[model samples]
Target: MEQVQQRLTELGFSTGGVDGGYGRKTVEAVQAFQATYQLEITGQVDESTWGMLFGSHEGQDIAADDPADAPTADRLVELCLHQVNDRYVLGTQADHNNPDEDEFDCAELISWACARLGVEFPSYSVSQIDASHHAGLGLSVSDAATTRGALLFRRAGHNGSKYNHVAISLGTGEETIEAMDSKHGVAVGEIGHRFTDGGYIPGIQYH
Candidate 1:
């Protein structure tokens, strides 16, 4: 069931995330698939739906079970929001290159979010590029940062050469949740300015 949900999400059908559970989102994904393939619009996974979905991935092996603590997309967003006022500490975690939530760095926040989902993400701002290579981790969002749980990235300094920063989407207009340096700490702020005029270039990762 988890594999099925994961497949639906990977195929861009948006089952919300592979938690092996059924809800309105899963039903909607099933209905959408049925409608797309001209299958009976039952909104239930029948034999035909299973066969088709399974057959489509003939060469791949679906996992027999999911990790007990793998966080879903919604949960990832919730966890990020839970740390709204965390102070920006430099070495809260032992590894400065790959810090955790308590470290309060931009990349560490993203890493912590992915870690909750059982996906490993480098906790350094510069090394965040590694996220693009993993499957079932998350999808890179180039334009749609408004989607909740999306991880937003911005290159910092003049001409974006100095460093990079990352944040989590609040899905509320152009706002984002992030630990914005020493003075601001962690809070929600307008993200649109980050991409306009001389601001940073915006990129996102959907967990």
Candidate 2:
């Protein structure tokens, strides 16, 4: 476990000191890592994550002799994402919510996913928009046109203040993202139509 924590820390995850125990800090760090990689925020170390921390190295060693190509961070993130399901939880960093337990939100999910993808992001919903500003990565309708990796957004309530919720594009116009909500374990939703606000993030493309 200490090794795991060390590996995660070396990968840019704030593990709060490399300890063998899995504490809240470790969970937070793992969630942060998962967010960057666009993976499901489960907070629990699983097979996919192990592969991410270790398998990639093995793969590189095998490919070392081959002058063809090498694995990329984006590819690793995508692999991790596919290994997870879409579910949501509350109060837990594994779920997209205010770490303070204030509200269940999607930005947590986005932030976690982005972390796993090696992208730095703010941990709030509104901040997500601001972070994407001028970056051309804010959610948009045209994102639905693409069938592969795309970000999804949903508008809710009457006032703009009520508008909340965001998700990753699952290539089928479906609002499915690796979420962690209390009701659902880790699943996807239909953005706006079934859940609430819906749109896609541009510029920061995921493949």
Candidate 3:
């Protein structure tokens, strides 16, 4: 619910600050979003509404001047960085587990961020890396480090092992934003190590 509110707020509607309660304000916002996008007139978020809200951008790269507002990678950066001091937990994606606030695992951070852009990245690193390879979204570590909003990961032990973590490229090649751990939580940190797998959001028109 907070994810929906935060996302709605990011896209220009005001959900009154991700307060988690699905109040009248939220209903009005969702309804406005649906109306703007030419969706059915249900104020409630349904399957089609969820898709349009979070996964409809297949080919639209640049943000449209019209009703369809597909966010860019830089926009993604702004969203992630906005949650800098948020919590971190093992399995929560966005505000799924915590309604009053947001919490994330490494990949879930990317998953949640990508959701705002209409890209559905998997909730974990192993599948995410595999899907990227199949979709040709995989990037070399060096490329990923330099590509703002690219997801970076490091794998070990074997081919089938999941990458232990993931981080987002900050575009400078020297740093990244990450939901690091329980102790460190989400923070902007130096990209000091090598990565074994990585990818970028498909619809985010990278320059």
Candidate 4:
């Protein structure tokens, strides 16, 4: 627990003490950290929190006001891009595939990145990207300027209401970072016209 507390402190969380217990102070500290990062105020150190402490996603912000502790956004972006060369799997947790190494899918990837950057973000469904009222902020998945760290959306057809696919904006204007599938792993692909929806949390930039 001392190690955990120390790690949390290094990640900018004020753990109050290096004690190995999750006491009220610890919970409050966790809640404070979560609130700052726009994460659900669960007051618990879940996988997402652990990922943040471990530096998996260094450039994305989980906290609205916290500036990235990372020296440069380019480093964070490069770290995320490096994972693109990895393999992808559906519905798998980021820590499961290789406990020895950190890898992720779309949702997990974004979540992990944001946590590390101390940015707050919400869990989202691929289909929710196109909903008239998204649970979070919305952006144009098809627009290049709006696609940076934005969620990519895809419809079954031109008139489909449900988004069947999702990806992360990689800032190429026409390409994005995606965890394709177990067979494909992770990679960058050109934006397809089939995708029509894009959304991202406002006031929360990925730099």
Candidate 5:
């Protein structure tokens, strides 16, 4: 079951948890996968579904999964919101499996949200934003106000990395959630003018 969950995640379907358990979340992910491939939506990993997922069928014409408008993006935002009051801790990754361990940093919060849904993400702002864009898993939104679920980013120095820090936009033009360094652990704040760039996060949304 854990393997299935991981496979689904790799295909851009979020199972919500990677625990080796066949619960409703797993079923939902399976259903989405099946539906995507025009297979029977049994919500169960039967022979055909398994074949589609693992690439066992030779004559199939398949493309990589695009999570541009997946519903899971909103959920990822919700997961970040749940950590609103947590303390900021640098070089620490948020533990999705343990609610009690809530320490996080700017990039760590995004990493944790992805981990909760079995999605893979880097632990630093620069890497997470840049690497994904290079891999075609992330899309930039430099025009128009960032829509709901868009990723917000900023840089400190004039010649600094555009992804110096990261935040989750509330879809609203102003609101966002992020671990604003040592001073503000995890807090609900505005995506001030400093946040000059935006992105559609992988496994989240496109814009």
Candidate 6:
């Protein structure tokens, strides 16, 4: 565990001094690393995470130049909008885990898009405070007036409630395509106009 903690720190995730202690900081660092590498954010160093961390001799390549993990933003957005009217189900379906299911939620919708585009993304809702959530995925956009294919996130604590949401930009003025809710399975609407705690994360590919 010390070796793993050391490797994590060397990979740019600080494990709070790494004294062979798998404390909260260590877990958070591991989760951050997993988020960056598009791995399962289990917070525990699983076999897959361990392999990636120690397998690379030189260093982990967290850039898009690694052709094996490149994401095409245009293709992702195109695919996301293609399934605009699927079913919306909570806690099930619509991720790499269940690719065949038609039902989806907000986070699931984004994950489905990533799968179709051959890109890696967390299938669950990603928190804004979570570092590395968008690492290597693309650039970060701060403006509401963003380009097409931009990934949007709704931070927690809206209207005095902790509810997070995600959606894909449709480039239709200010509209976005998302698996909104049970009532609106999947549809396009003015997400920016409705949500105040929203921001844009640029797509992996520009063209």
For TM-score, the strongest prediction is: 3
lDDT of each: 0.55, 0.50, 0.68, 0.53, 0.66, 0.60
Using lDDT as the measure, which candidate wins?
3
Worst 10 residues of 3 by lDDT: 58-67
Model 5: ten consecutive residues of lowest lDDT: 58-67
Runs in model 2 with CA error above 4 Å?
A: 1-87, 94-105, 145-147, 156-163, 178-180, 191-207
Q: Tens digit of lDDT per residue, candidate 1, span 1-207? A: 898887676654556567888876576666545533435656699998887677864323221133345454444554554454456665344243442334476766667667666666677755554354233234334333556656566656735535567776654446566666776555555666463111111232333
Candidate 2 lDDT over residue span 112-159, tens digit each: 555554556676665665555546544444454233445444445634
Give one clash count per candidate, in the order shown: 0, 41, 0, 16, 2, 0
| TM-score of candidate 3 on Cα atoms, chains taken together | 0.61
Candidate 1 total steric clashes? 0
Candidate 4 stretches with Cα past 4 Å from truth are 1-76, 96-102, 122-124, 127-136, 144-146, 155-163
lDDT of 6: 0.60
lDDT of 4 by residue, 1-207 (tens): 677677656655456689799875466555444433434456687877656555566335533243446423333333344454354555656642342234455566655555555654444444345342355566665553344566666655555634356666655565565665565455555675646667663323455
Give me the runs in candidate 1 sitting further than 4 Å from their true place: 1-70, 91-101, 133-142, 158-161, 195-207
Q: For model 3, how does the per-residue alpha-carbon lDDT over 1-207 read when each residue is reduced to its tens digit? A: 998887777765555568889876577566545544545545698987788778865223232542355557766665565555467798875653332346788888777777766776688877777777788888988889888778787776534644377788876676677787787566666777656767876666566
lDDT for residue 174 in candidate 6, whole number 0-100? 61
Q: Candidate 5 residues 1-207, lDDT tens each?
A: 888999877665567679999876577567545544546656788989888877666224322343543447656665665565467888786776774556898998888888776777788888876865676645344331346556777755634543378887655565566787676566656655666566666665442
TM-score, each model?
0.50, 0.45, 0.61, 0.50, 0.58, 0.54
Ranking by TM-score: 3, 5, 6, 4, 1, 2
Error of 2 at 32 (Å): 21
